[model samples]
Target: MVSEAQLRTIIAEAVPTIDAAKLPADVAFADSGIDSLDYAAILLALQERHGLVVPDEDLSRTASIAGILAYAAEHRSDA
Candidate 1:
């Protein structure tokens, strides 16, 4: 399953400007200064690497680290 560490790594790789290690778990990307473009890159990386696609309707469920983690735990697959 996709874990927080994996998510952080993805974020770090997707947006080099953002320090994923210091990112707050429950804070939304907007609150953390991660713009929509970078956030979309992170989401794309997650999809490309982990096969965890965040549907358009599920954007709210991935707005924060905690929320993304929860969504990954529930929807991430190893296939």
Candidate 2:
């Protein structure tokens, strides 16, 4: 099973500027320098990693790493 820590690593890799070890889950993507295009790229990478399709509406609900972790926890098939 991919733990939240692992997910954090994946996310950090997607957004290279954000330091995963120091970032709290509640930190907003915008505050962390993750713009819309970066967010889209992160989503694409996450979808490929987790094998899950995130609808646009569903993606709208997530604005932080915590949100993505929650979505992955709920939808990841590899779990």
Candidate 3:
């Protein structure tokens, strides 16, 4: 399973300029300053890093870091 730390790291790498300390675990990608393009980038990065396919619907619904983590946990086996 992908841990919260790993998820945070992934998010950090995807948007290096963001202050991770201000990013809440439950903060949505949009709320954290990650727009549609950034979200797509994050999804692609996750797929490339873990060899898992994140559904577009799921990606669209990922509004917060917690949501993303939950999605990752759900798709961990596939990864």
Clash totals, every prediction: 0, 0, 3
lDDT (Cα, tens digit) per residue for candidate 1, span 1-79 = 5788998998888778879999999999999988899999988888888888888999999999999888888875630
Q: Which predicted model would earn the best lDDT?
A: 1
The positional error of residue 29 in candidate 3, measured at the CA in angstroms, is 1.2
**What lDDT score belongs to each candidate, Candidate 1 first?**
0.87, 0.74, 0.73
**Model 3 alpha-carbon drift over 4 Å, by segment:** none
lDDT of 1: 0.87
Displacement of residue 52 (Cα, Å) in model 2 is: 2.5
Model 3 over residues 1-38: C-alpha lDDT tens digits? 56667667777888888976568877677777887877
Which residue pairs show backbone clashes in model 2? none
The TM-scores, one per candidate, come to: 0.90, 0.78, 0.79
**Model 3 residue pairs with clashes:** 27-64, 28-63, 28-64
Q: Is candidate 1 or candidate 2 better by lDDT?
A: 1
Ranking of all candidate structures by their lDDT, best first: 1, 2, 3
Worst 10 residues of 3 by lDDT: 54-63
What is the lDDT for 62 in model 2? 67
Put down candidate 2 lDDT per residue, 13-59, tens digits, no spaces.
87788777677788888888788987887777766766656788887
The alpha-carbon deviation from the true structure for residue 60 of candidate 2, after best TM-score superposition, in angstroms, is 2.6
Better of 2 and 3 by lDDT: 2
